[model samples]
Target: MNPKSCLNCGHKISDEFCAHCGQKTDTARITLQSLIKSDILGSIWHIEARFFRTLKHVLFGPGRMAMNYISGKRTRYYNLFSLLLILFGFNVLTLHFYLNLNPDEISEGNSNILEFFSKYSKTILFVIIPMLGTNAYFIFKRIKLNIAEHFIIGTVSLLGILIIFLFNDMVSLVGLWKPAAKIFGILDKASFVLFILFPAVTYWNAFKKSYSKPGLLWRVSVLYVLMGIESLAIITVLYRVF
Candidate 1:
């Protein structure tokens, strides 16, 4: 128990709920232990519940989860972009560490492997930026959220992709590139399925909430694919030139 105040009207409150404005109350003396017990660990559990719920709807029910999130019904579900960012950053850091430690394991035929990796590193930004921009557009159009919210979400998603790529590249340096490539092919197929499923589901719910049609919704998927290919092309050209 701690001193509490109304987050809404700044009224002091003793109970969990504020009476003056009928809003929730927040405790002031939050400790690290309390945070782990309440917010961090709790958020993780809550997010897990929300993730499964969203996944169910995202895979089969269609557009329901996004619609609920946009409607201010957030209680359990993970913040979409935050989840992506955590995963992405973790992947990238792990990959970077692995690559640096075992550079010789990455390639046998190429003495210029380091140069190759360095030269083409910038290509990732080209892919990520366009994807973020496109996702922002789709989020804005579908959810009617402001640009700022979409921008945050888009940034997280792009970070996730970058992490995946970094992981892939790092695996190449571990003498695992050949097998990893095959595994990645499988992942690519899986991602394609999810990519199609999520946007279509979100778009369907967007239609219900915002009354947008499916025809226009296809643009989001197109943009996603196009950005990916364009990024790959940029990398290829960079490799050829240098």
Candidate 2:
């Protein structure tokens, strides 16, 4: 294969690395090895690193990660949507394994919580409405980030619930079921707050960008509280129907 010229400056290069700007030379070498090492493997490692960085920001700095993402420092971290998808997949995989190991244990626990989740899948998605709606309002009034961007962030918050629940289950091996359940309940509550916090913080940052105060924060927060109630209500309806 002929070496490609630099698209930036049209400088010639013999190998993968462009000597002038040090960019990886784009070429037709999309082979299995090249694709694996270059595309698949490289992206995986990058996403893994981003995922951990996101985790640190979320756990230690609360609201900071979402703010940074809105500030356009996004390439350094996973997009909120990608983070949600990865966490959701992980949650599903681990939850299946954990439940399979001791099916009765999950069923034996607080029947109320289990009943709540099992009942309301669609109503949970309703949270997306107020979430995205407020996002639209803010996007227009503040930083002008699109409404779709807010929806993506809201999706991430929902996925956080799955992640926290799985983390609760996995971390339980070292201790008894009772302690583990208590920890999980607390984490679950926190995850609910996180769902609301993500959008609220993002909107807050958008307002900050436009030299506005966060006066609407509390009203928006009430929308989230209603959304949370809607989530539980949907769960109850589902439990009865299904």
Among the numbered candidates, top TM-score falls to 2
TM-score of each: 0.47, 0.58
Lowest lDDT 10-residue stretch of candidate 1: 151-160
lDDT of 2 by residue, 1-242 (tens): 77678876688898878899887777555798989997899989987897787776555443345556656777777666666656656765665666566657665466566555444533554466455555454534554556665554455445445455556556643234675667766665665666446655544543444443554555456656766676567666776775
TM-score, cand. 2: 0.58
23: Cα error in model 2, Å:
6.5
Distance from true position, residue 115, model 1, in Å?
6.3
The residue ranges of model 2 lying beyond 4 angstroms of the native Cα positions read: 1-23, 26-45, 60-62, 106-145, 177-217
lDDT of 1 by residue, 106-141 (tens): 686774665676556555543454555556466446
Predictions in order: lDDT: 0.57, 0.59
Ten contiguous residues with the weakest lDDT in model 2: 203-212
Q: Cα miss at 83, model 1 (Å)?
A: 3.7
In model 1, pairs of residues that clash are 63-201, 106-173
Each prediction's number of clashing residue pairs = 2, 4
